[model samples]
Target: MSQQRIGDRYELVEELSHGGMGDVWRGYDAVLDRPVAVKLVRQQSVTSPELAEEFAKRFRREARITARIQHSGVPQVYDAVLDDSLERLFLVMELVDGVPLSAYLRNGRPLPVAWAAAVVAQVATVLSYAHDVPAIHRDLKPGNILVARDGTVKVLDFGIAAILRTDVTKLTATGTPIGTYQYMAPEQVRGGRITPQTDLYALGCVLHELLSGRLLFTADSEYAIMFQHVNAAPQPLRELRADVPPPLEELVLHLLRKAPEARPADVQEVYERLRPYLPPPGSEPAPNEAGPDGVPDPTGLFRNPYAPRSRARAEQRPPAGEGQPAAQPVPAPVPGALREEIKEAYAHADALLDEERFAQAAEVLGGVVERAARALGPESRQVLELRTHRAAIQLLGGDYRSALPEFDSLADAYGRTAGPGSEQARACRAQAARCRAELGQVTEALAALEDLLALVRSVDGDVSEEAVELRRDIGMLLLAQGRTIESRHILEPLYDDLCVVFGPDDELTVEIAEALALIRLGLDASSP
Candidate 1:
């Protein structure tokens, strides 16, 4: 859609960017003689009288919303209006100068910690005010951050993201999953509630990346990257970049914890934590000192997270953050063509899955499963085993009945590939048994488990902590089948094992104790 002139005052310049919903353009205000950004709403994000009306209101109100924010970091809103046919709407905002933070980071150099902290402080200050005004950015990332020539950092995109909290859901029919996934907090990813800490967590990742010049987590694809953010423990920044101070290392990792409960409650805390890191004014060297290699820390500013780095926890430093000289960077293009080959198979396999040709997806993924199994060798816990996990998801969709037998075969294969006693194999076996149980083949499920358990017991390999709970599975199944005597016998031994493995105060033992008490009470009170 052509940018419609706003109120006969602003002339749309040229399209700057496009998203799922709309196009953004630079515009000139005839009266004010200043440049402004106008975002025209896409027709697809609107439908029906009610939606159109709400879209119109939100579109017009964006100017008012951005106007309410009083901060140097936030862009000033000039106007929001509907165009000639009333089918199109646009927002006019201060045209921020300079490239986005995403482009800045792509220059392939570790950003100095002090510079990163300075930038983050501005963000936290911006967020603190916005949240206090009962507004949140919802989407905050390097892409939305604008860095000007004078080192001024400005945050863009407030109005549209603000309405996304409620208005995005109202457009459910045609809504694409909004926001960049890499920066999404765990709660935001799950569609659960979000709080101020969510933004702070993302800031932690940004800071880690700025200091280390490496992604905090990475995978073969974007979705895998998101999955890691949501599930995996981030490798500590200190481990990834030895120059990271131990205290700051622990702090960033703490902020990036999978649970929001682990982060600082608000931006005030972020600001306070970052304040000291900013080099005292005027003492800093020339800007060209900002080389791609990162500002040299002759004294090793963040050599460790514990050092007397911040006055707050200097006493806790492990001998004043002194550590061995920084570890060399991992040379890239890591060899081992076998892994790359499997990756290529899985990438094509995932593409087929997205194209909805499950049969083809299964075939490619099957090859991946086989090759990865061989490359990882027998009884390996290497992550390549997750290929089977991905393959199983497609199998569960419409092909459950046929998939059931394949699942059984895969379980046996996994038994050999991951070793029957290993967590990966046991997880596969349990999933297979679950499918059978769901199909009302409980007897088959029990028999399969018994066979797996006997085989596992015969193996002379490491038993995962999961093995401790397998006995409980057997006991629970027996108890449900009117085999009270046998169930109690199994439960008694499992109860003893739990006590030995997990002290009485442990969470798992508490669960086992409760189950055992129920059986004991049942036997004492009545024969049944």
Candidate 2:
């Protein structure tokens, strides 16, 4: 059989593992020329077409949110792919060279106290960063944790649980909960709200199993295991292993508390509690203090925090920009096949936009923009238009970080191709400013908009649509910044212009009038 390809870029090499949600493959990225782990999730039994669409939206949203987490412990998400039918989903991620924590549990032998503590400490640090992103790992378990060759603990599937839980009963058609029974928090078993504490409870279960060589709770059936988690009291680690430290046992109990509120306040607190067990900075392990056979020492990080790579390893590292796919040189004239591909890409992107799939639309356009730029010259109108459309779609999808730079680049390109005073240039500049405002850089955004508003007025006059929109944006930004007087100064005149140009009953005119009325009420009330 021919090799399976995803998004026409990732080529599956072999199956790695299979789980309830999907099958993971060892894949190769044809574009980047690197190894990637591709998770193929097949949803074949959707009850209705409407439900499938909702699932696709939630899956894409959660995947984007998960990618926002910047940390070494969580594998970087490279891409998310959904087929036209929205049934076969693919998540391409950084392929980790590591062994799952479950491998160490094969012989039912407990790990050394320091080794187990080191692993959990690393996981806790990663969780602290993830929770700050507010991306909770609702299904954290041993199988999802990997110990890399360098002993770094990588946590997998950051947003997969939330994606599955979007409409669990309806999507799964089973009315079953969405976490591992043995490691699930009591609230999860009870169908209560999940929070960061839910992950902490799972962490406690992992630590207990690592130290005791057995699960925290066990039964023949999944329901029985869940029952033990919800209502049964846990046996203290000390009772199972006399070698367990008193404080460590106490910490485990605290994390596995029945109530979410009763667990440690957050992973940060848990990290602090485990610090006593971690190797101190600049310290070296004793001659006999080695970890399990074939397993790297987890304490190496604490012993030499942020150490530089060895000279040999550094020599093997690729220089910046090496190994990345380079754009093909453009021929004297663009090929017919390439032009056809560009046209098809644009048509597909427009259709996706009609369906309100903003992110996917942006992706579809992005897939062709690079090739179009190389073939048609970077400054060609076609390339510029494609970039502008993709940036607008990104802005609509709430990806201001990605949109801001694209808009800025498009503004400069439009000015070079069309003129500094061109409407297209001014519009791109305004969009960039709006992106800045969305990103909370209000002061800079206001300054840019004000300057652009002046430019718009000079070129198109004060009542032009561009000038009117800029004025409205500036007024609202000032109002948000608590500068009511300044906001009124800008909006009061613009409201009159809207009424004169489009009538008082026009949607834009009425919206401005309502805003002015609210500002008046505030000023009148504050006079006392």
Candidate 3:
């Protein structure tokens, strides 16, 4: 309801979708002044007081687990709140503006080879990260995957599926099957032990349908489809779609293998197999390539891949004498008359910044920076300060593409003027790394962070707040990259120090504690 508010902060704007677990609503966060998706738990799932309490705990656990997945392909979980009455459950998440994959699956023919492969490859990358969280998505269907306007494929309902797993297991009074029948793995139908392989099998079902433009196993009744999943052999992709490449077709069949172990070893292997079908960097996209609902080309990343992070790929920092950008000599100063003008411009920019006009503040500061560089000196601390403020404003404005190079240049400038290990240089490096992370250059971000962390520890010592914060950041970055063991190695000690320095009530301390708990959960799940 448009007039309804959940948790006294999120006002429901419009219902997005409704399923067994809950109704997803496009909501407005009044306090934050931003759009959010609010998933309200299905009232029927918590009809009794005892069941309501149980569901609340399950909801919180799953919400936290889902939030731990830091991939861009997974929507960020913002908050989970239960109403004072305990009659309602709400999960606030990033509002994804996209078209469900099911929209394209409705077409009567196969998608372009590159297009189909691109989607599957992205999904595989996401699965690799999800599996590391050790959270198996019980349901993987076209409906749960969305192709965002930017061509990023987002997997939805990771936690929601887990929440509803038990409820769906009870045989219905009518003997009707639950879940999307066409996408159900044979193991799922038989109520076998669900694992990461279960998701792979469902992915295979989805991939088959994408290539054939039809269900993997067609039947008139839901029960018939379930039976076919357990017994029927799928026809080869080429038989239905002659244009499907042999290698691609073979990969699809491998993913659809009847036994869990019979499938590819992991999503990584699935991605590698799909790589041959993906367009090479700088290659042209398929004709008429706009996806369903005017979504951007998903193949763009494959066609023009981000430059590899040299250091991270090598797993070693460059020697002191190598790989550094050449330094430039500072420019000579301009006339003294311009000094007052530059100061005035900076004042004006500061006023704009205080008003939250970040872009305009950056623009105002940019002129001051140029004039100050000329009137004072390019290497002057004043000039560097002006440039730094402008770069920070660009970042705050969400102009990441513009901010990244600025921060990089600022890092070099600060290093030259203030020494590489100076606080100013370290701050610039940290900001640049954050920019890289925001731009989806995770490897570069991690490498930059690690280098900065080492420098910070040498200058500030391990227990210094700066070093502690950098450690926390580095650990989170590692977690985001699915390097769970490395993340734990960094986070555990950082959390202990944070508790000692800032006390257990500190936000960063609490966050690191939660992260460590998630890491333990993954470890516990994998143990015998």
Encode model 2's per-residue lDDT on 1-528: one tens digit a residue.
Answer: 246889988878679999987899988776655568999875544668888988889889989988988999999999999988777888899999899998877789888788889999999999999999889999999999999887889999988877777444221135677878889998888778889999999999999999899999988977788888888899998888998889999999999999999999999999999999888889877654565687767887888888865432111222211243333334346688977877887887787677676765676688788998887888777788899989999998788988988888887776666665677877888898999999898997998898888777777899988888999999999998989999999999999888889999999999889999999999999997
- In order, the Cα lDDT scores of the candidates are 0.64, 0.84, 0.78
* Model 1 weakest lDDT span, ten residues long: 312-321
**Candidate 3 wrong stretches, greater than 4 Å:** 167-178, 286-293, 307-528
User: What alpha-carbon RMSD in Å does predicted model 3 have with respect to the real structure?
Assistant: 16.9
**102 Cα displacement, candidate 3 (Å):** 1.4
**Residue 6 of model 2, lDDT score:** 92
Give the root-mean-square deviation of each candidate in angstroms. 29.1, 15.0, 16.9
2 or 3: which has the higher TM-score? Answer: 2
- Can you give the TM-score per candidate against the true fold? 0.51, 0.58, 0.57
> What is the clash count of model 3?
1
Q: What is the per-residue lDDT of model 1 for residues 76-171, given as tens digits with 9 covering 90 to 100?
A: 877777775658777778887666777657765777666677677777778888788766676788877876644567887775664544434211
Score candidate 2 by lDDT.
Answer: 0.84
Kindly list the per-residue Cα lDDT of model 3 for residues 1-528, writing each as its tens digit: 014888777768678898766789987665655668998875555667888788778878988988988899999999998887777778899999888888886766667777888888999899888899977777789889998876779998887766655535422224333356787777777766788888898889888888888889877877787778888888999998888889888988888888898999999999989988888988776565545545566787777678443232222223222343436556555556676766777787677567666765576677567767756777776788888888888889788877877776776666666556667777877887888898888997888788877777777789987788778888988898889999999999898888898899999899999999999998899999
Best by TM-score: 2
Point to the candidate with the largest lDDT.
Answer: 2
Candidate 2 lDDT for residue 94:
95
Ranking by TM-score: 2, 3, 1
